[model samples]
Target: MTRISQTTRLEKVEHIVGSGSGLLDFAVKGENGYDTWEGNEDADWTVEDVDSVQNVEEDRYIMYPEGDYFICEIEADTEERNSGPVRCWCE
Candidate 1:
């Protein structure tokens, strides 16, 4: 007989944009190390994962490790609000 073991690790994360009123679109680097942008129909936003995203604090949001890393791109109506490539380590 053979035995195998596996572990699932999760961490907290936050999405920070220059200027935005609501949750911005986001994606994460899966364990396989790939960015899956299959978030929304437009592929610009992700469905809210209540379990992962905990709370919203001003310009920052609290999320968990649904993936290895977090990534987001935003196109705001104002130049000051426009931001992109906002990423962070979820591990």
Candidate 2:
């Protein structure tokens, strides 16, 4: 994953899509704490067999051919007008 875990903070947003919606449920990382375990520190998060990013959720950690990555976070835009980019960290 990018060495950006400690640098990036979850931006201020009005409507953040949380870990619910029956999505892939792994360890619940808060907005401030979600940056951990995404780099090369050897994580303790659970693993799921997701084939690709399209089948993943915002809370699930998956092992792919490249490696593992935090689930793509779907959050609202600046004005909560629409969905933002699906973002995640990997190793």
lDDT of each: 0.31, 0.30
TM-scores for every predicted model:
0.27, 0.21
Q: Candidate 1 lDDT, tens digit per residue, 1-91? A: 1111111122232332211343342332333322211112232333233336544556655455455444333233332222222233423
Candidate RMSDs in Å, in order, are 14.2, 12.9
Worst 10 residues of 1 by lDDT: 1-10
* Off by more than 4 A, model 1: 1-44, 47-51, 56-61, 79-91
Model 2, 1-91: lDDT tens per residue? Answer: 1112222233321122233222222233334322222221222223233334322465643334233334444332232222223344433
